[model samples]
Target: FHAIMNLFLLPLWFLSGAMFPISGAAPVLQALVWVNPVSYAVSGLRHGLHGFAETPAVLAGPAVCLVVTGGFALLTLAVAVWQVRRPFFQT
Candidate 1:
């Protein structure tokens, strides 16, 4: 389970711009960072901590990041609720 999750989570973390700013990354990587919810979360946190004016370069403005993060949260919440409502076993 640990290895399986790492396979998914590790890439997500790396592609999330956690190690470096997305601005200096390649176009493909920048696209990946833009789609990564974790990236938005991290950007939102950074903006909050450093204030919008002083944060490191990010894919989107603080408002955009906040909206995307909130949307991702709502989407995941909806998926979780949907899954919970489904039968656990099809037997």
Candidate 2:
């Protein structure tokens, strides 16, 4: 399970611009970064820490990033609550 999750999520972390900026990335990668929730979170943090003056070129500005990150958080919270409300199998 851990390995499978890593296989799925490692790319997400990599594409979140935690290691490098996405500006010079390939178009496909840039597209992926734009859609990634983690990317918005990273962008929000970057904006908070450095503002736009020193940060790399982000696809969305700080306001947009804030909205996207908050929306993503709410969405994930809703999904988690929904999942918890569903019936579960027991051994």
Candidate 3:
């Protein structure tokens, strides 16, 4: 639920600029574009739409994002599964 809004709706909201960033907005909001998956999605879509990669091949942003997200997901899932499999108290 939270991820859905963060990953999808926020980008749409930002693009519409309905409540933010016409020329002046919070620096934090501007910086969020770098980490929010929506930003990556938008940038990637723009590249595809324009028939060229948005960033140079040397760019590591996407790779870093993928690894970080992947690692977090895996780590959380592992912890959850471990907790399920190993109770705090056993008989």
Candidate 4:
């Protein structure tokens, strides 16, 4: 499970622009970064901490994060409940 989670998160770290500026990446990668939830969070943090200029997207980041986080929480909770309810004999 840990390995699987890392596999998923590792791509996100790069796609989220955490490893470098999004502008420095390829156009295709830049588009992906624009849609990545982590990008908004990072952009928001950067703006907040370093006085980076807030683009319209960056200005919306906090609200987007709240909604995205809530959705993920609900999805995780539903999955956990479903797993717990599964029959033990089911392989």
Cα-based lDDT for every prediction: 0.84, 0.84, 0.53, 0.70
Alpha-carbon shift of residue 51 in model 3 (angstroms): 1.0
What 10-residue stretch in candidate 1 is worst by lDDT? 51-60
Instruction: Give Cα distance to truth, residue 52, candidate 1, Å.
Output: 4.0
Error of 2 at 50 (Å): 0.9
Ranking by TM-score: 1, 2, 4, 3
Top TM-score model: 1
Q: Which pairs clash (backbone N, Cα, C closer than 3 Å) in model 3? A: none
Q: After superposition, how far is residue 39 of candidate 1 from its true place, in Å?
A: 1.1
How many residue-pair clashes does candidate 1 contain?
0
lDDT of 3 by residue, 1-91 (tens): 6996488676655743234433364666656644554444444444455554454321135556456546656876998799789978988
TM-score of 4: 0.65
Q: What TM-score goes with each of the models? A: 0.81, 0.80, 0.37, 0.65
How far residue 28's Cα lies from its native spot in candidate 4, in Å, is: 0.4
RMSD versus native structure for model 4: 3.5
lDDT of 2 by residue, 1-91 (tens): 7998699689988999887778778999988998899898887887888864876556578999999989988998998899899889855
Off by over 4 Å in 1: 1-5
Model 4 spans with C-alpha error above 4 angstroms: 51-61, 69-73, 88-91
Which parts of model 2 are misplaced by more than 4 Å?
1-8
